[model samples]
Target: MRFDELDSKMRIYETAADYCVLPGMYMVARLDGRSFTRLTKDVCQFEAPFDTGFRDLMAETAENLMTCGFRVWYAYSESDEISLLFDRDEQLFGRKLRKYNSTLAAEASAKFSLLLGHVATFDCRISQLPSENLVVDYFRWRNEDAARNALNAYCYWTLRKTGLDEQQATSRTCGLSVSQKNQLLYEHGLNFNDVPAWQKRGIGLYWEEIEKNAQNPLTGESVMARRRRIKRNFDLPMKDQYDGFIQSFFTRSPSRGIS
Candidate 1:
């Protein structure tokens, strides 16, 4: 057949069949010490989320998940939880949902249970977003909500710890908006300069470096595509996609400061 005829036939075949690809909404929940409020204040010297050290810890955790087999996009709720966007079609990932959820939950429980010296557990769920715009807005909403809630909780908790009555503490916390909480972080010698770059880019700010050096742990092949990196992890049990898995920590690049 002529080249043009062959191309025309191929297009018709492509249109008649369904294909699977990555890039969809995923939620990554991390179960760490439930008392992160006190633990964070003790370890980092300030409230959670606003505390740079705590944020760094969360970043490392996200990196860990990315390296394992997930496309982790953003960390949310100021606790140990995160929200991720996967790189596989909904149907493909759905096939392994049970194993994915259980393994992640177990990994989190083991890691944080030891890290925090307390019992911790994680649970995850996946959702497919029909469009890219919704994906971006979803993350923005989750992160902002996490920030606001964490700040308010800390404000009330801090006041109560200082012996303020319940009503007084609640009333006092009402005035501490997210901006004011950020200011307090600054006053306490903490930096709020960067709002997680992972949240913005769906990967860490150092993604370029990661792309440069990351190799598939299972196949020893270089996998440079972000979407493929996410798929490698998702298809891990299948063993066929191992060549595309990429490590999360290639190099640490400074983030571009808040959005």
Candidate 2:
């Protein structure tokens, strides 16, 4: 076969299942650490339940993803997962799902592994939300999930610290209610309410405009210039308040679809 013909034939096999997100749909890419339980607990031996170092690593990885070319409007990181909300008008790679899944996973893996000085990998998937309300609900779901996971982590670790084996600790917390979990931690002299808000609600990142004092190069006159930067929020609100936080990113007028 001719080289061009052969190339075209092989390319079809690679792209046969390619899918693109439709225009006007909100795209949220969620990247989860692969085998992170073993990686963090066994190999890296990070402090169980929560570690400030590990948390910072995840936050930094999310920040890298936000600035790595795509127009990410917001980022949320919790546990071993990072979620990025892309601008509605982002048309990169023709909005192909495979492009996002592959690029984001690779980007996160590379960035995190470099930061941690070990090999860590991440898997990514894109959520295509049809309406603004759904987007708000999606983040709310993750926000609430962070709270649940934080409670369980503290409870599980507390049991482990008090001589409970892995199986025993798991069994102890299995059917416990949220209040029960809080009580368990309270008995251990840890107040769930006193836990860092970032640990419970996760961290949020968004771009903000800030003014900088500068001097004009030619005139040497003082001037104020505005620039955009990624701002990290460790103190995220909860429930309805969080919904308002996510909705704030929708300030831009909605685009009907790709032109």
Candidate 3:
């Protein structure tokens, strides 16, 4: 048999099951770190629950994905996960879910490995939101998760620091409500409300506009021009306020800042 004929036969097994996202769907690619529990806590020894270094690394990695290929409009990160929002009209790789999944996971893993100076991996999945409201709900879900995780972290670490074993610490926080967890931190002289907003609510990355005065070389005239730039927001709002925040980015096109 000819090489080309044999190759055609084998390629079917590789490409036959490929799936593409349907048009008119808003796609959110979420990447989560694999085995990060062991990797961050045991191997790397990042500070328990949260570490500034780890947080910053995660932010940088998320930023990398934004500038990567697709026209990412919004990026959100919390815990060991990242979620990127792409325009509904995006047509990259013919909107193949497999391509987005593989490429994003590979890129995230590679970037993290480079930054950590060790091997790390990320797995990505796509969420096809039918409407823009779902996108807002999706991020609101993550933001709430960050708040819950933050409370659990502070509670867990407080117990651990009090000489409880990991198992004991986990067991103690099992039935605690959000208030109880906050009280736990309070009793330990750590105010949960005073904790950094990024720790409790996650951080948001989106575009903003800046204006600058420019001079026309020939006319010797000055003018104000607007440009778009990506801004990292640590103080994210919540509930309806947050919905309003996300809505502004989608609505306001005339106010983009100078990049």
Off by over 4 Å in 2: 252-259
Q: Each candidate's TM vs. the true structure?
A: 0.49, 0.96, 0.90
Give a tens-digit lDDT track for model 2, residues 94-127: 9999999999999999999999999999999999
lDDT of 1 at 108: 58
Which residue pairs come into collision in candidate 3?
Answer: 209-256, 209-257, 210-257, 210-258, 227-257, 227-258
lDDT of 1 by residue, 67-91 (tens): 5665443333234565544442324
Better of 2 and 3 by lDDT: 2
Candidate 1 backbone collisions, by pair:
22-87, 22-88, 23-87
Looking at model 1, which ten-residue stretch has the lowest summed lDDT?
A: 234-243
By lDDT, highest first, what's the ranking? 2, 3, 1
Best by TM-score: 2
Q: Give the whole-model CA lDDT for all candidates, comma-separated.
A: 0.47, 0.92, 0.87
For candidate 1, the C-alpha RMSD (Å) to the true structure equals 14.6
lDDT of 3 by residue, 1-259 (tens): 9999999999999989888889888899999999999999889999977898998889889988987887788899999999998877789999988899999999999998999998999999999999878988898888889998888988998899999999999999999888888888889999988898999999988767789888878899998878777788889997789888776655555422112
* lDDT of residue 177 for candidate 2: 90
Query: All predictions: root-mean-square deviation over Cα?
Result: 14.6, 2.4, 2.8
User: What value does the lDDT take at residue 166 in candidate 1?
Assistant: 75
